[model samples]
Target: MLRIIGFLLFASFFSLKGQNVDFEYIDKVYVPTIKSVTFHPQGMGIAAPVSDVEGNIPLLLTFDELTNDVKRFSYKLIHCDFDWRPSELMEMEYINGYPEDNIQQYSFSSKTTLPYVHYELTLPNRGTRWTKSGNYLLIVYEDETEKFPVITKRFVVVNNLVQIEPRLVIPANASLYRTHQELDFVVNHPKLLIRQPAQEIKASVVQNGQWKNAVTGISPFSFRNQQIIFDYQGKIVFPGGKEFRPLDLRTLWQRTGQMADLIRTRTSTEVILFKDKLRGEEPYFQNRDINGRFFIETQDQNNQLAADYAQVVFNLYTVEPIYDKDVFLLGSFNDWSPSPEYRMIFSPEEKGYILKKPMKQGFYDYAFATRAKKEEKLDFMETEGSWYETENEYQIFIYYRPFGARYDEVIGYQVFNSKR
Candidate 1:
């Protein structure tokens, strides 16, 4: 019976490949050689991948190619609607310059055992710039054609025309008050003209930039005097998950956080993290985390080119295998998307869930979660427990499509904290 269930899980995950990642618009790396993919505002490597429509701080996209060979890569941005589907608007409508251009800025690795090339591209550079504010997908491909995409990432361009007043609300339900958090917010657009304030104004609330758990296309709860409110009783609630477990791989010389053993080779380094435990039954303890984000850096070098990659082996020790669900590693490094590559398999001999992944030297924050065999939604109660007092980052995006607008316009964006 275990074998039969395992087969079903594997088959379902593999079926997602039929979407053809080369054309799919998502935050994913299609090639095995790409590592440490990040898209964020310029000068701020750890910020969420959001930029103002004014283009003062262009979005920066960076990645490491785990090879020495030089490859010609070109990139393009696709304007998407509120739901992430391509707007299908002409290229001239959303882009100010050429729709596609080559990625010419890169640096080769220096004094590192594992050779890699660091590539950087700033949006709104000399080549291309965004003309409209909305959802966007950055596609990097070979030979100037998106049909051979190597990586894809999602970023947002917003032109602030409204004010978002967000407040973290405690759930009123007895069962949810201790484990869940909710958002109560309002949008006031004083400058923009709107015919249907409740019908046209929509909102999306995202927690920790993870779209898998985001509430999208939300209608206004009430409206009064150019203000739209969203107080969903308990519908806009999220698990107040505990602070992510910290992992420090800044250097291989000294022991770091959770590093049980380190094996160094002439060409590579391997890390074995101490076994992780289920924290659901334990009381929540306050800890510092990057809010589930990672930044690539090395103490041994001044720049990113000298950072090395390590094969990390993670072991999660559960009382027994979760026979009904599949486990996966969740973090900003993978855009919090659970896939076969990040899935943890149960090891009989080790009596735990184990996953091996190659990651660049950096400070990372991560947690483990599970997905049911028949559903895509992930649950965290089995590994990292939830608590109402946990600190978390919330991103609120307000999109407008007044009556005749062809595409959704991102009129407001806000990033706030629960404990603030």
Candidate 2:
């Protein structure tokens, strides 16, 4: 009797364990995962495949209790801004293997453990037209009778092309070895061509070495035409008075060859901000109003310094004396950090904050920020590098059809222009 009773208890425990492990939750439903993501030859387009295996995008999901009731499953595509904020692009939805309206509905059975479903959608043809380019999240929600699970992933789109012709300039009486170089260009897109009138167009030069300063101007080329010409001047001056020779230009350009290609494909108007400030008597500041200035420079195609650095001077304001205050010049230049490399200091005689560190030639976005809890403030007063709100150009591209289809091979490409 004792042996039989012990055996029965052991069997009961085993059975309970099996049942508990098999239980499921609605949130645990398997999400159709996109495995390998790739782009065509020039990284001009994007592609991804969904599959279940190692070396693939993994979808680990669980579902609630099983039932034979669910007959089918479907999906919907939503477009969002660079920050994943919902935008006007959501009106467009394209799904594979289903009617447009029927795409959001799915048929499934509760008893089915693993059902096979494959769907693909292509974005409309607009080359580098996304107003902003950066990181974007794609959310895929499963359709079920009850609330379904959601899967999210990230992808990048870029538009860095410059439509207007760029010109090179060398300042007269400037030392070839010691003086900074500059490049200027204009955006000639017609007013009717832009989606937003408030958007500002920006021009930047690429160079081999670091740029010491940069500047840009925009105005109506003529009073009557309503047409505007943008002038971009960039300069690169070696720090500590060390002259940059022509040979150095060759090596630098070769190392940065991919820059042009990246600009062409991923250019967008997405603006990121960085800010910093310095007070009187601080290490890097000058006076109370005239703060330190900042700028960027880059290389051109001929292995010579292409343009002068774009310059940005920060304006400092008088504030109540506070001790141990900290300020930073934050932006894409210093990896968007408030570190010693990008710190700003005050100069009492000069009445401003100063940036003593020399920056390499390139386009940069930066702003001012303070550390004191009471003094901490976001400074929009002094603009550095390039302002984000300026009108910029973008290109969009749409690649359609499955990867293996012979006739469907990358069948579509288009370009759209957005201003603001």
Candidate 3:
């Protein structure tokens, strides 16, 4: 009886673990030790993890494991709906070649106190290729009987069946003209028979590749002569948050302007930045930034294996701690997620919020944001003010799924910038 009960319990554990995955828009790290997960098109260090369906443009996937022992890892792709839910199509409908393949590339860290292993893989190799054009969730898991999930990243595959013309404009509304930017666009599906566009078509607008706050389920305003118009003046608006704060950790030997101290120990290095003051009320000034992006690099070593990890300490000085809302650090390094893992702790002694996390050697752009309890929406107004002059990237994705379709097809895609 004891043996049977133990076996049943073990089976139940796997069943539950497999059922509770929060398949969402942002990158997810199931294992705590996995750090610095990045997925972008090859050669483009800071770009959306999007690729053309026929370009054979492989994406670069890389991450580091804190443990010393190298482990077997494999990846599989799952088709996702426009809202990021798993689609009805089976795995074979979207992916060609083997369903899962072993990750054959990895290297151990060198010349660093914190021992780790770096893994890099160019996607769409001989092992696997994609056949559909839509949102996909790439899940990396252990190549074992249990198939434990290690990390998951979101990306898009566009078929380019339709052409999109998108542009950014200053909101005509006097109230929002200076603080918000508006988007106007048209989708020309000359090749596609887009009937019932208001009911059959939906679109999503993302700011800087951040899907967490992306505006989804928007339908076209009008359809005429195979052209779809999206003219939601005030409805299609985004807060023009100030430029991202820059952190230059490219070289630890020489401190940067905001860097307060660099502490080197026998095992690891600590990069501390001088306390940051709240800038919500300050005037907007032109500042150089990567629009909340990061690129890994080690100036001294010049390779992934030689790039060491560091404990980055962030100190935000606030006059009074926000008693009602919680603050978190947002950056491309962490998929701009406002999760508890990036949550800052309030230190009454310092009268500010603080957080520390492990980061690979790189130049990073980040900003502090706040959110209310039990809310997923983040507020940057308390920490960083909004300005129409802020530079930002906009991604417009158009999905089409007629009656009885199994999945949403990304027929049109375009990128727009607010700088101009």
- Residue-by-residue lDDT tens digits, candidate 3, 1-420: 999987986775455334526444358777779888888999999888888887477899999999889989987787889988777766667778875788889999987778888898777888788888899888888765677778889999988888999888779687997788889899998888976898889999999888777888999998899999998867788888899999887776777887899898787789888998888898888887888889988776766577888898999998688879999999888777787799999898877899999888888999999999988888998799899888899999999898888899998888888875
* TM-score ranking, best first: 1, 3, 2
Candidate 1: tens digits of C-alpha lDDT, residues 20-41: 4547777888788888998888
After the best TM-score superposition of candidate 1, give how far the Cα of residue 288 lies from its true spot, in angstroms.
0.7
Task: Give the alpha-carbon lDDT of every model.
Answer: 0.87, 0.29, 0.84
- Per-residue lDDT of candidate 2, residues 1-420 (tens digit): 999987986675455223323212111223323211111212222122111112122221112212234323332233333223333322212122221122222233211122212233232112111223322333344444653434333333333322344443453324442222333334444432333312332222212111112121122232113333433222311111111111011112233321222111121211111223332222221111101212222344332122211123333433432246666665423323355655666766645565544223343333455566455343322222222122222222211122232211111112221121
The regions of model 2 sitting more than 4 angstroms off are: 1-85, 91-162, 165-185, 190-227, 231-322, 327-372, 375-420
What's the true lDDT of residue 31 in model 3? 73
* Model 1 stretches with alpha carbons more than 4 Å out: 1-21, 144-147
How good is model 2 by TM-score? 0.24
- Evaluate model 1: give its TM-score: 0.92
lDDT of 2 at 53: 14
Model 3 C-alpha lDDT versus the unseen true structure: 0.84
Error of 3 at 14 (Å): 16
